[model samples]
Target: MRENREIAHTFDTLADLLEIEGANPFRVRAYRNAARVVDSISQNVAMMVREGRDLSQYPGIGKDLAGKIRTVSETGTLPLLEEVEKRVPRALSELTQIEGLGPRRVKALHESLQVNSLEDLEKAVDQGRVRELPGFGARTEELVRNGLKRLRGTQGRTLIADAEETAVHLERFLSGLQGVKQVTVAGSYRRRRETVGDLDVLVTCRPGVPVGKWFTSFESVETILSQGETRSSVRLRSGLQVDLRVVPEISYGAALHYFTGSKAHNIAIRKLGMARGLRINEYGVFSGDQRIAGRTEAEVFAAVDLPFIEPELREDRGEVDAARNGRLPELIRIEDIRGDLHAHTNATDGRSGLESMVDAARERGYEYLAITDHSQAVTVAKGLDVERLRKQLQAIDRLQEQYDDIRILKGSEVDILEDGRLDLPDEILRELDITVCSVHSRFNLPEAQQTERILRAMDNPHFRILGHPSGRLLNKRDPYPMDLERIITGAVERGRFLEVNAQPDRLDLTDTACQLAKEKGAKLAISTDAHSDSGLAGIRFGIGQARRGWLEKQDVINTRPLPELLKLLRNT
Candidate 1:
């Protein structure tokens, strides 16, 4: 799976490099979409290849992509990736990650100034060479320099989705090894953080089991940094570090709790233990010379006189006190969601059609699904104009007649224009069952203006929900400047909902923001903003974010049944 992810990354990099090289736009999009499909699917890419399955049968996978997937599965590298890297150096591809530097700018920096690496980029900026490049000004150069500085501070962390996929792959691989008894992934990865620095895996095995050799034998292991009798560290080909610890069964629980910690949370718990006349560590909980608790995480918590706290809530953010008071939140789960309110189709930028999206949602047991394609403002998405949207509404109406179990809601993800106007006319918006408005461009607005824009947009009588309220794409870009508190407060006042967009890359209305909205008595909708059927599965990621924010089913608007949901919307 790590190899699959690595290959997907190669395709993504190739796409970026191709775009910079002035390749066909469609060709670049094919690679980008293929990367998302490869990364998001649940099936194992390697297993599919080993079983002689046709990879092209998967969505977004054509003959060329299937061949690349097969090649990576078999040989663990893609020749095309190598060929592409020869044209665009890896360091230059990395430069695109800096917020202000797109591929074209990266290419300009590379060719015009011979700035191929971050070091080279810095030197060129210092020498004022970047400012002199075509299409680049002094301000842009400064932004690039600042983006580089920010990148350096947060370089090694991997997205939670990527780390989770790798962790599952490693866990399965290790469990298949001889004498392996129990395997658990601990650390920020286990806590379900948005990003993780590395993985900490705890394992217990039969006596004298040769686990160290198995750790180094993983196909994705690029290099073994260290190997010892009880512990080993390896770096995966994806540049993710993994530490494996072989613990005794007796101490496994204690070690799991200790390793699966926010440092601050663990310190607080340790202080609690000390006050109780107990010594706690990774080994076990002790009261003098006798071991008291270490057999399970529950036991460790019992020893500290606290209820078991969920990992996502173990951030020392009132969770300790909540646990002491028996008030830990019964976190929201995927099953609690009854429907998805924000989805797209081929009528817009989405890869699938309305029927397919609804079928996927129905299969997931959703009582209803919204077909919220983009409206006119987002030209790149081929967003719907007035007549086209009317036709789509009719199409959804026709599709709804064929379905007895799942209801289809006619919706539009209408763009909130630069001046706070909706992309669609009031009559068109009024025709829809629900309207999900979002900001698409002019992301550089000042905080006051951005907040005002959103506030004014929410003031529209047709607005039902604010989509991806923060305009954030994790790792790729920071959220546009806005006063979220004011925006959320406006939502509460307007009887509107905020979205926790569950796309793996854009878990907007971040956990803290979700909590703020909840605290302010503003409802939230955990929508996938799904572009494909597979994307419908992203709701689980949204659920994770909701749980971390202390949101329960009652706090999520989509958890209501159709009748109740409709009533709530109408009343609001």
Candidate 2:
């Protein structure tokens, strides 16, 4: 069956092709919005189709888009996409991923230079042909060159969210099989990196289970690369390669530790074992040919005289030294989060309404939920003006009376202008319980100007948190150039907090940056920046990032009680 991601990709391609073909703007937008809506849903869309449920009940999915979803779910392809691809090269959709090449430019390139792929576009730029086109110039050619480089650099990597979806489904499938003792997805995946090249799944099962064959036979397997009694490798339909390995139960911990590693962390651990006249590998820890400790990760750590580090902290970035010195931080967990400080409603680009979002947050037992819709500067999101914001504030006031269990903080994700001014004025910002300032335009500014721009925004007394501080979109866009360390310091000096946006694609204030914030005495808020109710679940990704960054309950501002959180926001 087709996954939600597959359906979304189909619609996204259909939209891209339609736009390139100069189809109606409204038609193109419908498909684009449908893709976003489908991707945001947490439930199995294919299952819904199989069960004959009404797909149009979903936000932004009209009757027409709903039918298309059903078609893709049942057939594993979209007829419209196939129809469009025959006229417009399917590969052209990929060119739209370049920073400066939207569908119109892609169309222009195709018509003027016959550029069909990245290679063709590169050749055209090299020949100075792209710059001679009407809308293209030397700067655009440079952007294409740089974007192509970044695209190639990230070619094989998959978003962590997509990888997680595949891993979880396969893990459950294997776990349900007879005699399967354990299944753990290790490697960069287990380390919770923002993006992964592939997946490594380790398992321990009863003898003679033929787990390898079972793995190869899984429904998603598109190609069986190799198979053996204890090892197997396969490529899934989504183009992600997965390797499965079976190990003895006694060596499970050792194998997991070895596989769930950054090479540096493993090497460090091996050095520690070697210093004690012990050898450590995937099998077990040995002292002169005598097996010692390997039954559990804790046992392995005890043998090396260190505590078991969390998988997220196995990056060898001061974690080992911290472990040795007994300074290893108690990383924050999802449960520690009391509220989400960044979120949107239908008043902006969000699909859900205020009441629904409130109910979802209250159901999650949050003490507060901030409604930070986009401000006027973000015109694309239907950003709210002063009058609209005031009306929304009044609406929140009325809605607040309906639910005593959660505080709905009236807020706006105000844009930080290039010159360092907040999108919304102070009078309106002061009325808000929180202000999440962000950068939504001019991403290519030089480092000094960009740094100064944010610092100037921070000078505003009402700026509480910097939302998605780095403005990175996981495989799609690189973080704009800026000195994060200086920004962290400036945030510290101004008592402003940085945000660890929980969106799977934009876990900004990356793990490393999170650690920098923690080190520089700057606090952080791990917010979902959710656009839909289901988007609230993205908090898990942020928690993983925060854990990788060595954040504790104290380092996160929203981990506090409602009153304390309010106090912190006010003080900022």
The CA lDDT of each predicted structure is: 0.88, 0.92
Query: What's the lDDT for candidate 1?
Result: 0.88
What is candidate 1's lDDT per residue for 145-257, written digit by digit as tens? 77877788768988887887889889999999889999999999888788899999999999988898889889889899999879999998889999999999888889999
Q: Which pairs of residues have clashing backbones in candidate 1?
A: none
Question: What C-alpha lDDT, on a 0 to 100 scale, does residue 302 get in candidate 1?
Answer: 93
User: How many clashes (backbone N, Cα, C below 3 Å) per candidate?
Assistant: 0, 0
RMSD of each: 1.8, 1.1
In order of appearance, the predictions have TM-scores of 0.96, 0.98
Which stretches in model 2 have alpha-carbon errors above 4 Å? Answer: none
Worst 10 residues of 2 by lDDT: 1-10
Model 2 per-residue lDDT tens digits across residues 398-423: 99999889999989999999999999
Give the lowest summed-lDDT range of ten residues in model 1: 1-10
